[model samples]
Target: MYLEYSSTKKREALKLERGLARVQGPPFHHCYTVSPASQPPMWALRRASVSLTLRSRGFNVGASCVKLAPTCCVEEESGINESREITYGGFLLPKTCFHSGYNSSLNFTVGKRALSSSSTKKEDDLEDGFSELETPASDGNESDNLLTSDAELSDDDGKENVAKEKEKTRRGRVESKLFNEIVNGPGNSVHSALEKWLEEGNELTREEVSLAMLSLRKRKMFGRALQLSEWLESKKEFEFIERDYASRLDLIAKARGLHKAEVYIETIPESCSREVMYRTLLANCVSQNNVKKAEEVFSKMKEFDLPVTVYTCNQLLLLYKRNDKKKIADVLLLMENENIKPSSLTYSILIDTKGQSKDIDGMDQIVDRMKAEGIEPDIKTQAVLARHYISAGLQDKAETLLKEMEGENFKQNRWLCRILLPLYANLGKEDEVGRIWKVCETNPRYEECLSAIEAWGKLNKLDEAEEVFEMMIKKWKLSSKTCSVLLKVYANHKMLMKGKDLIKRMGNSGCRIGPLTWDAIVKLYVQAGEVEKADSVLQKAAQQTQLKPIFSTYLTILEQYAKRGDIHNTEKIFYRMKQAEYPSKPKMYQVLMNAYINAKVPAYGIRDRLRADSVFPNRTLANQLVQVDGFRSNPVSDLLD
Candidate 1:
């Protein structure tokens, strides 16, 4: 046989004695198994190989050209035979072994000739309005960190590294598929999205749900986030951890309201009471600045004999700091009484708290105590120290600490610059502010840009603020917040035309026009005495689905109407804000009530409505009024009683 002769000749030529087995099949079909005794030469590793001559009787050529399986697929009357084979270096393979349909199977590598694997991924993750891969699971995990030196990788090492890359790629594809199927579905509630999908035998794993929840929470889709959390709870699949309940409650409070979240919490079974839900509640209370409610919550925890961690105490400390900051001492005293040792977090908040006041000696003593307790301060601690130093008029000390932080490889960021820029701007040291701003411009983060804009805007340096805006646009696409800030700057400079054009540009660029943008535009119209234009903005905002204005925009209109003695429009705007679910504050109602009183237009109706709503007149509403009206004096200070 030609096969026998060829096998014998190959063994003789390469000195590789391989055992060859021949099987009987159709005359045209030849199957042979060759077991190599040793590694073959690189030239012998061929795949999808055949030994039959091109002149075989079973084969036919079209257009007088050879149409082998490698060159073309043979369409037969029987089941279509697709190529399911690969060719190594001139190696022979049986015809029937891989004469089936196509499948992406494994391919072994020869020396230096690496084959690329082709895999497909979904478009949902990469499409517009979604880039879930921007926050890839292994993003910023550099392979260089895992390497010891610039040494050449061995065969095994190369394969392993390739495997890891492929694994990450495959994981991204899976997550994209899962997200498109579940998260982006038309189901309003989490139950409708995932429950049916699982019941239909589709894979909806616990880890996948957890990842989806994290992404939703990060994206601030708290309504969908709450739904996912509730769905996860209903499934009773994974054991809910402390953070699970805490995060779910937090989302409920954020997406819905505190009362609704509290109602949801009360439904938690008594058996699931081990984790501290009170801690999350304290954090929310702190954000709300409800001193009385926070105190009551803490006291109730004491009455309930609930165990308090250092984190819980830290939340109470931040809450106290926002209110009567002097009460921060009471938090420390409470910690001491309860034998709760201060963590790094405790000291971090304390350092910031102490820094806010002219307590240089107090800060020194706290640092001494931290050292005494064997706690090395972190970057935040150092940053807080710099804040305290600058506040205490110790500029040199602040600069020296900044250098020390840099030496420690604490990367220069917006937080450090924000603390320094304001101090320099306050001291009228525009040079120092410029120098620090230059450093921040190199980073060009959104928050740091706001800080830079604030510095330039406060100085009334129109040219410099515009320069920063231009730089922000060049470095990255302008965000909604950036556009709003630019509009404010334009307003300050009396460049209303440019601001209007910028709003148009934002809309054209598919950016959501937020409440802030409308607020700025309305203020511009109000300043120009274009009352009808301002009203048009309000009407357009009410109708817009994407750019639906928040309560603040409506408040601006109400305040304007109040200033103009238009009680009818004031009441209508107030009602609209309430109907649109814009989270009405008592301050909003109080101002409108005062407007009614000033206009002498049945003030008792508004007053009685306020009383029935339990709206206690706010004292700090004048600050917002000052911002909008550009007033140096509190016009509505007489609104209280």
Candidate 2:
């Protein structure tokens, strides 16, 4: 509500004017003046004074209050313009509704005294026309006269009309109850009904429907919401509501996530401050993994108002760390300019980002910056820097940092051990690795050290790797993960024989064979041309894994036999392949043909090659024919010709 200035009035006068309006009704209700509940009392009083003057001239003043639902469209005089409405309760006074009601001719043109005089005549005839009326109020009370005259003018079915009004109010309340249950209650059936309502675009208000839609979106029932939105779009009612509805149609864009909903964000009103918009956009961006957009929104947010919350700044810093170091520097500069105090996350982000770039000097600069700002780098920041040093092969620096952390009562975190152990092993710093392990002895980071032990074996530092594994198994009494790690390392380095021996050692130690263990053994046997041994390994692997042999597992043996030109062996493996029912490629038939030809079985070989060419006609197998031990009329050549 807008108010005209009164230079002479004191605060006391304003309070008195408000008191008069509450009892007597607003004077300017006919002119569409409004007094919103949130309006300062002082402003309300001034509006009341103007309103009092209009009412004194016989304008009818009816108090109207609107309680909006969460999502609604603001009413527009012209059908084309639409504004989004936020639902709020308590007091809502709009200027236009007042104008329509108070500016009625009988309200403005006829004086109260004329209406009161006519009410006396109507009361006299009440017995004839309105027998339901018992008695009218005594004549001396002008308030009662006003009430009676108003009732009489509407023709004396006052009791019945009041009852009807009460019924309507009851029905409105009931509808609101049903709507609340469907949208907010725990029942799935109610939720489904609301979804159906949204789909139909029926007589329900947009605010209630949109509220339910957003709730469904939050719950990740996007498919249902999209189906409803699409149905709503086909309706005549929702078509002109807002084109941005399509933008808000992210409910169905399962793959796009929040990235798709972002288009609708800009449609929010310009009247909203940059701070509000940025917060909303930032949240949406981070939720959808759009780190770049999160950065852009954060940058925009700072241009308007530097975020002061620990959460917002931390999130922005995290994004910077994950992406660009330059952005971290930019954020630091912005932080100082905005007079925003840097938190631990700010320092951690700068350090981690710099470390990722391997800019040791940059990381040193961050430390110096933190000291200058009187902010201590926390354990996380130190861990990041320590890890960077280890990656750069600065063992002395990393070790010194870890020792310093210990002296300061900061136990070296498990994550740092995970990183440093592998790094030391790769650099072959066995002594440094042992020292870290001893430090971990008193801590809970022993398992993390296991990963590093495996990394040593992978780098072919087998003696050191075996030493670490023995220590973990004998001293730590840990699980078979240590053995598993060793197994992987051997297999990765193509030391399949070593892996098989390790599997046998594991079995001897009462560690029954894991399938991975058997797979390693089978690979070794097959590579060593021990087909019978490989088949035995496969059987053992199946018994250990409990699950049926995967196709690749059987294919592995068949492929080896076919490649070796061992036709007898390939024929024996074919029984297993048929039982497995694994899909065979043209390559398999070609390999079979090669094996047949190698066995001096040309008839079988040529027949298989022809079948291969028919099924697959490209590359090696797909060629017209192989001119092997030149026969004048090659079967494959004949088929191609």
Candidate 3:
């Protein structure tokens, strides 16, 4: 027993019939729709005994019992087109009911409409049974119109529709197949899966390959990203552009080292080796705080006669801001001589540098200069200003600037909410933090939620922070960043057991515990007075991830050891940091010297060590050295005995 219906309507009807079959307690037989080429010959006969009870909207449509040793094929005479067939409770409608045109005398609609009627209770029950299926709500007239339209569609239109659907499915499958294979493949290397994809005769477009590379980079799978980049370049299917070369160069630097990246840059054609390529290398250098190498890259850019832009100058300013503030004036002079105007980032760097140096007057002068040049501060600039103001102990100024940043419509400028939450919390303005959080609560973004958690934590509202974290995990997958925020809160309040439980959850959930999570975990154990445990976690992290644990991870343990006057462990950790190739900074030396001072037993080779590391002592450090040298005459080591 078969019922004829269009493909779209057939899907809905099949779902409804399955539900009815389950309720009627019968073994449901599988049904297949006959295509045009497979239709039975006209006038053929078959022996069958079939019984069908048709029901719609809980109303009985009567029953039909038929036994035929010779059943005539009346499909052609009934005027039925090549529509598909579905079996419903072994029921077959009369031959005349299969007419292409609607039969008003039958008083029953076919397809989804057959299950839907004017009775709201029946409709509700049907919906409840098949809630996953989505069918449009329509009255009897609309359903009739829909069926008529389906029947009236020309054969050419049907073929075109199917072809369009097939093409869409093919395109989506092709675009995501390579990416999925690479991500879910067994090993770290994507080379094998990528090669397999090509061998499988799947077409690769430049857009598809480029998108895969971009996504890999975002995931920080630099090794896989570099492999994909190298594979694509080796195939030579697409001509290399400047940006493409630059992307590969950046990948090489990240996966390998900057020196290897430099070697690769030399292999690039001069046509592709333009300023953008050099700037890419320069940016990577600056990010690593490799001042000497970065300057060399800058010189190479000049030697190539590439026109220097404000972007390159800003990078130099940023580098100088972090290491060697004296070089900042030199970069500014170069920018002035080259007639390159300062960008917003350039001004912001200068402002931050001034603020860090505690030169409030200098920061105001930069802002004045920015205004004079007809450039208004952007949101980032305003946030930087507000932060410095708060740090300078000027709450009124920070509040005024924050209000201006909020502007006329706080809701419209939703981004400002994340920025303001922390600043308000830092100023101890609980009400302002609550107000900002309320606006975000309506439709919070991921980053805004993280900021709210951190802000609530800073305000010592553990319950509120836990509530937000709980709500967030239910909506989104638990990311390490989110977990790190709550962990930091627990660490600050010295909740060791809570931090340990979160770590266990992170492992069980397979969250990617990267450097940030490592930093937070280290801080957690350190704050809990388990310095030995903190040191062990750092060692384990170095072995686990390809990426190095961030500098702060080591520094946290070192600082704790320094406070305890554990000179041996302090020197050991400091040497480990140097072995990690972290650039020497004055703060590291100051902390090491503090360990000696706390132990009251320093008198040997401190000056030589500082000079060997190329770190100059500040006035305070100079005074400390003199005090430590005073220990030489007294010989505190002998005093300890």
Candidate 4:
């Protein structure tokens, strides 16, 4: 039979159903009655073979019944002549309480009564129910004491969990808000945004600020990173550590120049002036190829009596390796005198220098020395060796080294997978490239995907390259670096239309079009026989970004102009390069001379222009200069006549 419930009593009906379900055994009749003197409200639970009915105040309460074990009942009196017990799910209830308000305190009281009751089995049942609900049960006076302790423990645990959750949420919000503000902030200045964040009462932690700085540096936002560093320093909220000072110095050198960065170093308090700060400056100098400034910084480190670390010496070695190979011997001699053991990087640099000069035997000797010193080569060093081996056409040696790097289990050597892809491709082992790429298929990392695309492109497998590129874009928000890789692949194949489509996709995806993307576009247009369009793209990139296009980018366009004998456009590009403040190299002048030669016109005072730019011509360029000068004395037009 169905029982009707009015809207007002629907909540009570639900409570009745839950209360009945708590009874654990064969159904038994139980009644709750108020004092006769009061407006008595009576409720009863009655069992029939298949149905149990509940009646409250003589009206059938809507509920379902299940058999449940009997539990002790408790009651409280309010100005009544008599009292009755009210039990709810093996717990106590006050006369005014509803079933939904069952509390742990009530369970403790019921447990105490059950413990003292004569029936041992009933007491065990009550204890079992208490254990299920994670409620404390005890005998007599001890129950109250145990209840107090349990409440305190539960409160402490709840507070700890809440605190941890709040901390996690706070850190997440801070990272999200601060990153969004600095990265997507208007214009180049993020200073105002940072200040606004502070004014809004957002706390900035050292870890969060450092992470933001690192991200900015990666994005090549040197100016904005410097601003953030300056703001952090000015706030004086945190004590500046040595690494903090070093990071600021590096940013200064990047955003400003080495000279300005040196000025900043002078302002750093003597207490914070450490070896790392100077090493940072020295490294930046080496990166910029400023040999004179690099040496001066190295001398200053000695003047400060800073321990000459292998890192600093390696920086000098690297600079000398790129600039003057002859000076490398001098640096090696200094390392020997100082008793400074060379690091793996030191040996790698030396090896690469020897490889560049095609000194295979010397490179082998260096490797032997590294092993003799008991310092094993790392993956990077082995990769370097493999690269040189391929360049030297020692394919057998390169293959053996690559096999060692892969080890017995290729799947576990994820770190070596990306490096191996291109090496195998260089070896013309398409099968090995495919094998390495298969290991990355299940969970491809960004670098691995990039390497795979490059490897496929190198092997002239355009379809395979495109497939990897497509898969990478779907899985990741394409960074400009990733897009540039595919663009380069398309550029190499002279697929202008595909490159153009990718550029549109990059724009739609909000990828930052940086120097790398510009380089790829320039190559794409040049390879497709539209040099003018390439030049236009370069110009637009420079204007939009207010940054210099890479030296190779300008050279690419200038070389195209040279090939066409378009001297006017070639001269224009050369002048633009000068405006961009690229160092004058012999190759640029040689390209300029080739333009004149291809035009079959004598460029008068070309040597004077080279001398004015302080660019020294090599022997071959000197001979070209003489040939161009002879043309002026004996005109080509005269010979034709």
Runs of candidate 4 with Cα error greater than 4 angstroms are 1-181, 184-202, 295-309, 336-339, 600-617, 629-641
Better by TM-score, candidate 4 or 2: 4
True lDDT of residue 239, candidate 3: 82
| Worst window of 10 by summed lDDT in candidate 1 | 71-80
Candidate scoring better on lDDT of 3 and 4: 3
lDDT (tens digit, per residue) of candidate 2 on 258-332: 445466556545653444444445544533334535545554453454434434544444443332212232233
The CA lDDT at 48 in model 1 is 9
Cα lDDT tens digits for candidate 4, 1-641: 11122444445534553464354222122232322122111111111101110110122322233343222210111101110111111111111121212111111112111211111111111110000011122221112111111111110101112222334356342334465567556766678888778888998987778767655553456777888888877878788876677778888887798989999989887786556577677767766656557766665665566655455555655665444333344344334334455555566666565555555654664565556555566555677788889988999999999999787977865756777898899999999999889898887865688889989999999999989998876776566767788888999999999999999998897776767788889999999999999999999889986655667789899989998888999999999988986656556787887898899888898878877765545444676788778444446678887
Q: How do the residues 1-641 of candidate 3 rate in per-residue lDDT, one tens digit apiece?
A: 11234667546545643433333211112132332223221111000001110111132222222121111110010001101111011111122112222211111233332321112222111110101001111121111111111111111101112222334356352334566568767776677888788899988888788766754553456778888888887888788777778788888887798999999999988886466577778767766667657766765665565665666666666665565443454445344334455555566666665555544544665665556555676665677788779888989999999999888977876656777888899999999999999998966666678778989999999999998998888766576768888999999999999999999998998777777788789999999999999999888888775567677678889889999999999998999899888777666776787898999976488888877776656544666688678535556778886
lDDT rank, highest first? Answer: 3, 4, 1, 2
Please give the lDDT score at residue 296 for candidate 3.
Answer: 65
Model 2 residue 315 distance off true place after TM-score fit, in angstroms: 3.0
Top-TM-score candidate index: 3
Stretches off by above 4 angstroms in model 3 are: 1-181, 196-202, 302-308, 630-641
How many clashing residue pairs appear in each of the predictions shown? 9, 4, 0, 5
Pairs that collide in candidate 2 are 27-51, 27-52, 28-51, 71-207
